[model samples]
Target: MKKYFTQLSYLLDSQAKKTIPLLILSFLFSSVLDVIGVGLIGVFLGLLTNPHFFLQKFPDLAFLLQGLSEKKIIGLFGVLIIVAFAVKAILTLLIQAKVIFFCQLLLVRLKNRMMIAYQYAPYTYHLQRNSSYLISRIQDNIGSFIGNVFLPLLNLISSGFIAISILSLLAILHPFITLFLVSMFFSVGLVFDLFVKQKLSSMGKIVSLSNGEMIKTIHHSLHGLTEIRVLGREDYFLQWLSKISHRYAHAAGILVALQQIPRYLIENMIAIFIIGLTLGGIAAGFSISGVVAMVGMFAAAGARLLPTVTQIMSAINQIRGYLYQTQLVYEELVELESITKGSKKIKSLYQKFDKLTFSTIFLSNVNYQYPHTDYSALKNVNITLHKGQSIGLVGPSGAGKSTLVNVILGFLEPESGQLLIDGKPIDNLREWLNNFAYIPQIIFLLDDTLRRNIALGIDDHEIDEDRITKVIQMAQLTEVVQQLPEGVDTLLGENGVRLSGGQRQRVALARAFYHERDVIIMDEATSSLDHETEQEVINTIKTLKGNKTLIVIAHRLSTVENCDILLRLEKGRITKVGSFADVVGISS
Candidate 1:
């Protein structure tokens, strides 16, 4: 129980100061209304026992009751009761509304922070986590925390105040009966709490894990649809989905049983206790009115305790589960480190190289290992490219080709070694990156107009229409655009699925070309294009020979045959470096 409250504290930390006041106000109002109602009941009973009870108690109070008969007195008491109820209702609504509103605000803030953290988190964080789990935490768990945990807590506090008022009234009327009822109530609550506390918590964990698994199964099935269809594994996927569904259903059943059975048992016990107490009170020579008031007090107290006890238990379970999920998201956000200002400012592969020289682009004893990998992807690799030089990087698969690109792009840091650009350490040349652009093998495009996708949200003033057109022509995409109904304005489907693979590659190339940076790094950019189209793009790149430095990665030997220099890498080390012809002869 202490642990549960500790966890609740952390969950409420975001809104604690703001919500506490409203909660307290609501509870106070509820207690006041309940006490006033009980006092009214006692007064009405006293008037029944003696018509002039109010008059005898205080003469001034009696004068205020002049011209009012018994019915009118009862009616007046009813009005007071209604007023008290109205005040309690209004206060309760206001506090609950504030709490729920503040909870929503806190949830939105937390989600936004998580999103921002995701952007800055290291690549390994993404690799280690599942998208479905993250999505479930945001979409489902936060809502559960507010509705199941916070709302129930609000209800529990309000009910507790009512219970205390009722118990106090009972004490004045019949102390022994009040004590007996209180003892019975607590005893039953304790037994129920002990019986289902662990079960509720365990059920909550099962439900949460099952929900994540169900989401994962659905996500995987949809994302791997093509693979599933191609392999004729629809039934297999369905079976897997069914297993998750079954687990969720089983856990839900247990949760419902745990929630309902204890409440039913406790309610039955309260009913029996009420019946026994009523008989005993009459036997003890209590007057008819006193007995009625006692029964009324018992019923009112039960009304408060039953719902409060049930809701509190369920809220505990819900809060525990939600806190775990929230902790996952919070931990993820807290762990992410923002990219340094220097990294973002480094030149892209397409930057200009007027003063860039061979010695300017040098990596000394570079070493890098991928996350969770035993061996280094790039080890002690060294190379240099001069300005205006066209260099081709050739290597087998997993030969550190992509890792090399990632390093230069500042997406990954080397375990050891220094990368330099323009005769300065790469970190110092943050602003120097404006002169380069990169075209990766797999291109991504928004589901928007071809022109907008290529321009990538650049303002019209910054857009170079002529340069864009030139690149389109060079990449052989002009014909494709012309063939479309909207030409350059035509919308590309999601991930550019509307375009052929080669066209997608060309669009990426066009974006790089439009940038017109001093250096262009093509990481297998032309692999998807036909031999002829690839040649045309290469020739177009050569046209800018004196203006830019070009570094190309190609699997096709013919593609790099005429390069100024070629570097062959193997096992994270550069093994051969020379002109294209010289390296090819040595490789052969």
Candidate 2:
């Protein structure tokens, strides 16, 4: 229990501590109102059974009732009792309204915290985690944790206060009877709770783990729909999905059933206890009138006490059921915060880097190994990138070209190295990254207008039309756009499905050009283009010869033959770095 709630407590301390004062007042008001409302009903019952006997016990009320007859006094008490209950109902509604809003607001804040953490977390953190797991935490686990764990935790506190109020009332009327009923019900609650606690927790674990697996499977299948269909592996993924979904459904169903079972059992058991009390009173030879009044009070109190206890138990079961998910969310947020500590100044990846002058980027004695792996991905990688230089990286698979690029791009920090911009070490990565615009091998295009794809992140009205048009012509996307029905206004289908492979590469190129960045890094950018289009892209690269820095990663050496310098990396080390002719055996 301590282990499960450690993270939860930390989350509450960080996120929801502001609500504590108001939340305490809400619970206190609710409990006090319940006590007054039920106490009025007890007075009405006393007046019904034997008005004079009750009036005799409360002689201090004689002055107020001086001229009133017994019947009239009883009638007045009935009206006041109903009024008390009516007032309590209205107050309860108001309290519930405040609570609902408070709960929902807390949930929203918690989700926002998770989003910020994920956004600011180091890129290395993202690499080690599963996309499905991270997405599930943000989208699904948060909702479940709020409903089952957080809300229930609130209900548990509220129920405890209300139950104490009812138990206190019972104690006032008949101490011996109150003691007996409390002992009996408490034992039953304790024993039943102990019996089912482990079972519910186990079911919760299964549900949480199974939900993650199911989401991962579904995400993988959907994201790889094209590959799955082309390779005829649909049945394999389908069967795996069905198996996980079945397990998730079963575990979730069982958890729900367990949370409700205790309520029904407690209700029936309370009924039997009340019946036994009634029989015991009859056998003791008390008058029916006296016995009825006594039983009536117990009935009203028990009615309240039973449900409150049942609600408390049900809430507890739900909290236990969702224990794993709650802990996961808390830990994720906390871990992200720790990993991304001191990153406040380095916030925006799109911040202006033009003001920071840099003549060269120097890498000295850089070595890197991926987490949980013994083998080094980059070894003693020493290199320099000067202004207005075009560098080509050519290597076989597992040659660590990407790793080296990642280090330079600030996605992965080298284990032991000095990466200096000009003469000083680069400290702010987000600021450093603003110097380059990256075009990946596979471009991720939104199903939006062509203009938006070219000038991404800028609003439609805010996009620079002249820049978009210029990059389109430069990247050779102008011809394709002109052929479309609406030109730049044409909406690309999902992942730019509407565009051909070569057209998509051109669109990506257009986007890179539109950024107007100081440097451009193309990751196999022309692999999708035909010979003519590839030459077009190469010609486009040549246009930046004296204008901007370029880093090209490609297997086709012909594309990089005109590059100022070629880097030939074999294994994890750069074997040759100089002019293209020096790096390669033959000249361009």
Candidate 3:
């Protein structure tokens, strides 16, 4: 419980923290009103059973009732009881509504905060985690934490307050009876909870784990649909999905059953206890009015107490069941927030020059190893990139070409050695990255209009239309756009599923062109295009030969034939660096 409260505290901001006290105070006030309401019903019962008994118990109020007949007094007390209950009901509704609204508002804020943390987190953090896991945390686990864990925790507290209030009133009316009922219910609830505690926790873990696996399976299947179809593995994925979904369903169903079972059993037990109490009171030869009043008070309090106890028990179990989800969300947000703060500190060192004044980037003896890996992805890599020069990188599979590019892109920091800008070490990674634009081998397109995809992340009103048009022509996308129903405004669908592979490459190129950074890195950017379109894109690259720095990684030798410098990489080290003739043993 302390751990979960700590998690909540980490997630809530100052305003939210302040509101908690107010909510607690409101709940306390509502509990007081509950006690008063139940007490009024007890008085009404006593007056109805025997009005003179009420007068005898309260001699001070006997004078106020001297002129009134018993019926009129009973009617007046009934009316007062109705009014009190109505007022209490309205106040309770308002308080609960406020709590729900607060919960929803906190949900939105939590999501927004998580997104911001993700955006600013170190790139290595993303590399260390799976997309599906991260997506599930943000989309699934967070919601579960809020709804199942946090909200239920609040309900548990509210129910506790109400139970205490009702129990206190009953104790004042009949000490022995209230004590017996309280001890019986408490013992039953505690034993039942302790008995099933571990099982509930285990089931919760199964459900949480199953949720992640199911999401991962679905994501992989959908994203790899083309490969799956070509390989005829649809049934394989379907079976896998079914297996995981069944586990999830089974675990979740068990959690619901466990929460509900105690309610019926406890309710039956309460009924038997109440019947026994009434019978025993009569056998004890208690006065008629006294017995009636005692029975009446117990019934009224039991009516409220039973549900409150049930809520408390269910909420406790619910919190236990979904405890894993709370831990996951808490750990993710805390780790991300820590990294985000570190990144912000790094970004704070940013010196915003009007533009990148440096004409060169130099990497000296750089090495990078992925987390938990013994071997380095890049080893003693030394390279120099001059502005306005085209460098082509050629390597076999597992040659660490992409790793080297990732290091240059600031996605991975070198374990040792330095990357320099204009002969000085890079002080700000963001500033260094600002001067480069990368076009990855795999294209990722948003499900938006062609224009928006090209000018990605820019708001519609902020997009420069003329620049978009110019880049579209430069990247050979003008023809494709013209063919669409909405031209540049045509929606591309997710990951550009509407467009062919070659067209997607062209869109990527257009995006790079639109950004117009000082340096452009293309990883097999034109591999999807046919010879004709490849030549067109290459010619476009040739046009920028002396204007923008270009780094191209390609498998095809012919693609780098016209480059000013060629590099051959093997096993995480640069094997050759020279003109095309020097590296390939042939003249261009």
Pick the TM-score winner: 3
What does candidate 2 score on TM? 0.93
Candidate 2 C-alpha lDDT tens digits along 1-588: 687667667766443677766777788788888888777777778778887755676888778878888899888888887887788789878877877787788778778878888877787888898988888888778888888888888888888999888888889878899888888778877888888889888888888888888889998899899999999999999999899888888988988888888788778877887788889999999888778888888888877787788889899889988888888887788777766664653454325444356889898988899898898888898999998999888887678888888888878888988777887876666667767778776788989999999898888788988998899998877779889999999999889989876688788878878876778887774344467655744775688787888888877777777788889887788888988788777664
Location of the lowest summed lDDT over 10 successive residues in candidate 3: 345-354
lDDT for model 3, on a 0 to 1 scale? 0.84
The TM-scores, one per candidate, come to 0.82, 0.93, 0.95
lDDT of 1 by residue, 1-588 (tens): 676565456555555667677667867776777677666656665666667766775678777888988878877877876787687678767766776777678667656655655655555566778989877776666666666666666666666676677678778767987798778767866787777777766777777777888888888888788999999988987998898788878877877766676567668877898888788789989877767766765676666667665565555545543455545544444455234222343223223344233335777788998788899999998877787888788887778877887777556778999777755665423344555677766677989889877887688688778877887886678789889999988999888979876678678767766765667887874345477656754674566566667787877767777678888988888988997767788543
Clashing residue pairs for model 2? none
- Find the number of clashing residue pairs for candidate 1: 20
Quote the lDDT for 381 in model 3.
90
Give the TM-score (vs. native) of candidate 3: 0.95
Q: Model 2 scores what on Cα lDDT?
A: 0.81
Clashing pairs in 3: none
Residue runs of model 2 more than 4 Å from their true location after superposition: 1-5, 13-15, 69-71, 342-355, 459-467, 525-533
What is the overall TM-score of model 1 with all chains considered together? 0.82
